[model samples]
Target: MTGACRRARELVSDACARWHLPELVAPASVVLTELVGNVVRHAGTPMQVTLTLRRPYLQVAVTDGSRRDIRPVPAPDVRAEGGRGLLLVRELARRWGIAPLGDGKVVWALLPAA
Candidate 1:
């Protein structure tokens, strides 16, 4: 899982650099990690991560083989390591959402490119 997260971060960072949107690297990396990590830890199924340039936003999408709906919950315990991924996504992303995709779903975040 750690390796997958690291690779996702590197991919997002490299894409941001290539697109000349260096400012997006940090947020995009964070968002990707959180989204992908969620799939790894919870879904435990096949997943796909994608980064795309969409006008003024850089979009990150994680598609997983699960139909369960995901929602951001407030962490009841400050010391808990889990349950904070979506919260971080909400904070860092310009906007985020989950959409049903056949038998699974795609969780996505958009960060401002400008």
Candidate 2:
């Protein structure tokens, strides 16, 4: 994993720990992993992951160098083990979206801080 991604996980876990929210730490890690992995896979080098916390909510934003269109597509079959990262993100995250950056975009996911 990239340093930015590893730091994101640590920051999120630390934030949850500070808030006395141990329950959310693991899921946050997993979701962060998937999103960050996507960035690493699709966007090449020079990526960043930012983490924000707001009492009951936590937002993770991953910035990468792909101005090209990228959208999360579900697997064609339910039993398919691959191409399910975004689906897992959708299921576990409270809300998620992509936002335009300087020349790329930021894929963000929000989760309950608790």
Against the true structure, whose TM-score is highest? 1
For candidate 2, lDDT tens digit of each residue in 1-114?
Answer: 577568768977887788787888888888888888787777775777777887678887788888966665656586766677788888889998888877999888899875
Residue runs of model 1 more than 4 Å from their true location after superposition:
none
lDDT of each: 0.89, 0.80
TM-scores of the models, in the order given:
0.93, 0.82
lDDT of 1 by residue, 21-114 (tens): 8888888888999998999988999989999999888889999999988865576478885777898899999899999989899998989888
Clashing pairs in 2: none
- For model 1, give the 10-residue run with minimal summed lDDT: 72-81
Assess candidate 1 and give its TM-score to the true structure. 0.93
Task: Estimate the lDDT of model 1.
Answer: 0.89
